[model samples]
Target: MDKSWIDWADWCSKPYRAKLEDFLNFAYVNRDPSSRIYCPCRKCENRKFFEKVIVRQHLHGNGFWKKYKIWDKHGESRDGADSLHRDEMFMGSDDYMEEDMVKVLNGWTDKSFKDLLDICNESMPEGVNLPNSYYQAQKLTEDLGFTYNTVDACPNSCMLFRNEDINLDQCLICKASRWKEDGCSLVSDLGPGKRKAAKQARYFPLKPRLQRLFMSSKIATLMRWHAEKRTDDGVFRHPADSLAWKDFDKKHPSFSGDIRNVRLGLASDGFNPFRTMNIVHSTWPVILVPYNLPPMMLMKQPFIYLSVLIDGPKGPGDKIDVYLQPLIEELKELWDEGIETFDASSNQMFQMHAALLWTINDFPAYANLSGWNTKGEYACPSCNSETASIWLPNGKKFSYGSSRRFLPYDHKYRKDPRSFNGLREYRRSPTTLSGVDLLTQLQSNGILTEYRREDLQTRQMMGLEKPEKDPLKKRKHNWKKKSIFFELPYWKDNLIRHNLDVMHIEKNVCDNVLETILGVAGKSKDNISSRRDLELMGIREQYHVKRRESGSEYFDPADFEMNNDGKDKFLIALSETRMPDGSASHIARRVRLKDRSISGLKSHDNHILLQQLIPLSIRSSLPKKVVEGLIDLGKFFKVLCSKLNCAADLEEARSRIVVTLCDLEKIFPPSFFDVMEHLPIHLVQEALIAGAVQFRWMYPIERCGE
Candidate 1:
């Protein structure tokens, strides 16, 4: 041993004999002080013989002491050099860590990282250290191909505070502060004009995430499955195999030429994440789903990439175009210029082209993105034909209160031709204009105007559409003539840009159905006219019981007898219900189905009513045709919720629903065809034409929200 090593041993033994003994044990050293063992540590590298002194220097070296302290702190037996062997000290740690990781992965949003760490720490024994800090845990997760890219956003929610806007003092549109002016969100002191980032939005990019998908051999194989694995024997194995997708490909051959290229569907909706209806805060998250994967895995939350988040107190509404600027620019680059991307499965680099196949959103979001007012006189986006709406007494809003005529205008329900009073007109436009023509007509001065003459001319034909009554009245009739959609390099056709989401349409229609059924509105099931009709069907029960001083029934409506089985089920669903607090029941009162008064039903309650209860309770009481229509509607939704194999199945289901709803026009009250209800029928028809599969349904997202 060297003389310096001997001196170092003498120095360590004077102050740290206990530590030296621990180190000697950790290095598996012999007891004899003179005995020579080869030093296998990285510093000495086996060239130098290990004496007690040399081992002490190596363990106590400035570079090694910090980790040695950690070893000591954790009651670790091995020295820093033997870290790989530290696994022995951490016996059962892998299993424990894996269990913790599952909680992090599954319910990430449920608890903050610090809270998760605190909980984990609480479970561990005293002196037992965790594997990583919260930030280190996040870094480790990122290394595992899951993480977020956060970017600062404008406080006003006008745009993402990045690129050119990064240096901007205030938002150009809303003129809101770019930083926390009051120093509330800042960590450091802000003096006068100085500021810190006030608001931030998490953005997960498509490129790296898509590359990560390719990294997994299983997913990479599935990504190419749409083109290679699918059978092309006149069956809908994929959306590309459907007629609508094929037609689009035929129209734009260049886009469809590369079968390996990815196709994506964009969906966004403003939802109150706070979960309180009274507080109107909406958060719009834009999700991009790769349709290249199989149906079963396509819409999974983990698989779907979040492209952007539009923070909101109020939803961006039509101004959503402003916030979508970054995404649109990136999409344009992906489409026109393409990006150099590597496929880990194939082990090759290629120029990747991604196409935005279609946007899926509700009517309001559709109007915002597509620049067509969904609440216009011609509310039907597919046809752009005249629509009939009636002013509701209770709602205080005009609802499309008549059955929409199909494009051909051949309908027995049309009671008026020139007047178009009871009959909704079906004047489908001669043709849908290309995006180029639309842009030319809209942006006459190189900037999007509030309204287009062509659109106004079409609206002129509708009697309800006066100069003052243009539906863009919400924007004071200043509807942006051009939308961000017009700028999409790939979409030359406007008709196909926005897809009608079946989910939102169904929910809205279902809500209306529930309101109508529960007597929540005057135009609904409990209406005087409908009650009279129900009473005629031998379905009368007592209601509006005005108790006299003698407690005798006065002004009783139940003049007819009720059927046993139907009345029993109907009464069970509606007769007496627990109060909101669940403390007591509203006394079991005998009430007619038509005279039922109930409110505050949740979305799932509506689902239960539509899926199982409605048909069972209402069938025996209403007219035969009305009963049949309601049963058919319920059956259709249940069928949709079942296993569907192909696009043909969707088309068949849509056709049956349309026919069933059309047949009920005379049977149901006019309010049943309110715009909310009318919209879904057309949306389903459009989805059938577009060849949407079950994976693209909005129900999944809404269910996720819940």
Candidate 2:
């Protein structure tokens, strides 16, 4: 079709009208005249659909979108050489061709891009051609094979309108209308009226995404990096070097036989999409990282596949399993019945299987994923029901202690009482539960034997029904419900099913130490209440609050507390310190000299401060014992976070951390030892099993979201 009429200045001309009629006939073709087609008006921009008459009226009134020359969405296609040749015409004559095009395309409308192209074509030699507009240029590189399915969900998260419930207008369980209640016109009027869904989840299918990885020759080779190119030395560098990975291979030889088989790590967390504290909304996104790639490229944004996006004004919480239904179903299929993937590097089709090795999340999210409560008494997932916790009445929180039990049986710290909670530690470390032990406990508790056989068997797999509870009965266990991942055949057998985020643990520990030592008003853990807790525990007497004759109480300064001068000097030292560019954000700006406190530190900032700055800055001002403990803590993190670590170093660090925690117990009040401070003890064991912390940590996942 002749598109010269698009360049005509006058829309009223007879020649333009004749060309417009010809274009309309071409667009309509054999279709019904009443059928709606995408409007090419400036206002609509092919987003709105209109009847043929309304579309013609829109084109006449607003003019055809000048850049839509190819008309791909409107049933027109460039044939033969024309289709393949247009992409080359738009290629920029520069080394940074893609970058240059992106710069030109930024904020440009279709007509603006077309006008620029017209200027370029007119100035260039007669034989040269260019892509008519931005849309045409974009089509050349866009992967139309990748798409997301929008599944309507109940506003209350009861069920998704899918499969058996596909045509249902309302939720089967909740009986709530599937369509939005707001009075708005249906989106597409030509078809049976379809209202906007009340709530919807976007599921990017895992099968095609995984297949696309093998379609590229470079990526296809990289997908087998773990098995093919990785060094098999005992040193820990990648997930493949981990004991868990090896154990999985030993158990399932058939799955590991193909180096092309994918191993994936799942990570999820809720973030405020609006990026404001005032907005009371949470949106959860589930991301998957393929561990089959080498360590260098594994966590990069390009390889991070966002499989499911759960839209939320409120987080799904335990009901997140409802949203994970599609992804889990695809994973099940991938594991049982492999997908036929064509490998560009090998030039052959192969059956590809994938298994979710583990999930990575923060403490609160750990509860949602693993169905283990990470709060109250049984807060430690590693320790399970044997978590050593004591209620601090004055501090109004649970203070976790008993690090001495983890120490060697004959270790000197086990005999010393004053250094810890003023009692001898005779108990052994809490028993580590195996997969069989966990299943046995669940069965004995009636979770698997009764609930699984009855409720789970009767209802839909992904249905959101709260487990029945007696109103007056006291809860005896921390197990919320069996995790959705356990439905997978091999979930229970995996050594590590869920991971503890080292990033959050480091940040919390840093905050506690920094705030308490500096005595940052309300933020300090060593407040009046903490001193009273020490008095209640009948330990650390010198640090207890003393009553004055005037009926006011004054607490004695602990060894960790810094005087005003010390605080000033410490703050000033941190403020004056400079780091290499890109090594860290500007730490100087976060230090408040007048306030004598550090503020507005992000997770990575805290990581740098804890690992590098605090040990250096506090040595001059703090007591020798306090400084030594802080330094040991810092060194523990520095070694644990190393890119390459040996088993001997981790084993030694494990014993060293026990002594560090014992020393800290002597210095800081009992209230200082929250779950975060004690969690470091278990981190080494996890690292020993999972290899480097980098592969399983939340830093890459959190940064990718940003």
Candidate 3:
């Protein structure tokens, strides 16, 4: 166990080679010699995997990662290490002790904080003691350098009281007072020198947070994982393997030159911070996930940076762009003139630049970020002006069909009018608009006007007020305003600017399919209105409501809908089902036997149901064709949600999903195909370009906020 050779200057020396061979032999003793092992070379840093022979060669060429004396990754453990060495590593470090203390204090609640402290004090010997109070423990961890800056915001979200406006008592645009109005004061004044701001936002500066990623040698190495250790076998395990990432690299070689240059995905969603449905309030937190790290670390809470917390009693809809000012300014600086960051792993300083690859959000929030109206006839963002939608008079909502157009031209579904809407589909899939194309459209349509801080100041200086909306322009296009993200120099060139969240999409699809099949009253998509829509279309006559001689309506049962007996069997099967721990929640708890339906399922539960459970549960109850169609839909999601995918597989999935939707169209009423159902047609293509759905989805972001 003598580690003296690890520090040897001459790696080629016979002594060093002999020691390395000994270490390798010891590490790979019972394991296969040809199998991959963690290479401990200075260049590899135990991050890259290599065969034993290659690892030996790397060690000889680059020397060992000198600090990695204990080979924990290579089967060695701290328990087997010399006791004295273990004590020196842990007990001797004051910073380590303080970090451990902070972790313990963080888990303790206000009611249990004192109880935990008393227990710690009793356990420790004579003179040793833990912090006496929660505040004392908090102060102990103050040196950790975690903090947020509070900036007073206009109550109307008109502007932030920062820089030039820091001294202003009232908003220049609205003439509203900055401070909260006193309840007892008569003249909007409480005779106070300082008062609480009407609203405040927490801004966590991006530069320092990005720089801190490299301060630790362990995390510093991980930050380069996408470029360094990722397998280049054409499989999409990480975002780096995706076409969009490679395309970005090809277009911007300078940014890609350094592997350490950060690639970030922004996710912002409003949540009820109070965790109560009765209280209608929302707080939106903008989080940035650094994609430079490998899949496992990138989506984790600790690595996700909270750039801004937009305070809200009412969610900032389109006005969220105002709250994103600080973040955007920092991002602009990061992209233009990079910041100098010290990488602990390399022991050198280098300029680190970052670009926001895309944003992850649900459909409603997508409208707020992209400056597009995600409702009405032009709801589908990808489809844009070409969105295929029809208003169902009875359903009173937009039903997105015409899925046969997305099918192959030679496919029978294209010519089969009877199976789909009353007309045959010859139209091809809609063309996806490039960022440049969108920008040009916005400019031509007169919707690309500047709306940032400088524009506001310019308007104020000219003694001009905000202009009235152009009725013609509004009627002509869905463009609300050019997105604030378009201001970034590279935003236009990026392929996927904002991702469609797979989490919510999957849940919605599952709910639609499940409720309709189960015939859950009120929630089911196959209601009386849906039947009326079918009757108006003059298709599926068998399903239309018939007026009996007695005047009671007689509706024929659809193939997709389960009968009372079938419903009982389906519910019973789901209730009796057991899942692996942590895979999903208890199915029985969600199953309401009295109601004969499932309820209170969380997002993950729905994910599981969509991918695996529903397909299994429906096989015995539903008709063969209906069962096959639902199973195909389930398979599509299962493949889409995978952590690893290849281009060929995704391409096949793309074709398969189109047919699946067509088949679903034939089975369900037109009213069942909402925008959520249409979204799946594009998900496979996105997975091919953006890699696995897990990284782009809101599941991790939602869990982190909670």
Off by over 4 Å in 2: 1-143, 183-194, 448-476
Worst 10-residue lDDT window, candidate 3: 83-92
Q: What are the Cα lDDT values of the candidates?
A: 0.57, 0.82, 0.83
TM-score for model 3? 0.81
lDDT of 3 by residue, 145-202 (tens): 4567899988877788999889888887667788887676423365555577888899
TM-score ranking from best to worst?
A: 3, 2, 1
Best by lDDT: 3
Candidate 1, residues 1-706, lDDT tens digits: the string is: 1113322434345445554555566544322345444443446644455565675667555212322233322223322233423332343354445755766456654346557666776786432344445565555445545566666666645566677656666655446667665535443245545656666666666666766676555777788877777767665445656566666667767766766568888888888866778898888888888888876676787676778776666676665665666677778877787777666566666677777877777678888777776764556555443454455454344545344344335654443432223334554323444456656645553334222333333444443243366444444222434676656765765336777765556655666664554435453443554433333322323332345799863543221223444445555665544436653234234235554543554444555556666677675555566567778887776655554345566667666766676665544444356566665455444445555446556656655544
Number of the candidate with higher TM-score, 2 or 3: 3
Task: Kindly give the stretch of ten consecutive residues in candidate 1 with the minimal lDDT sum.
Answer: 72-81
lDDT of 2 at 268: 97
In model 1, what is the error at residue 364, expressed in angstroms?
Answer: 2.9
Q: Against the true structure, what is each candidate's TM-score?
A: 0.66, 0.80, 0.81
**Winner of 1 and 2 under lDDT:** 2
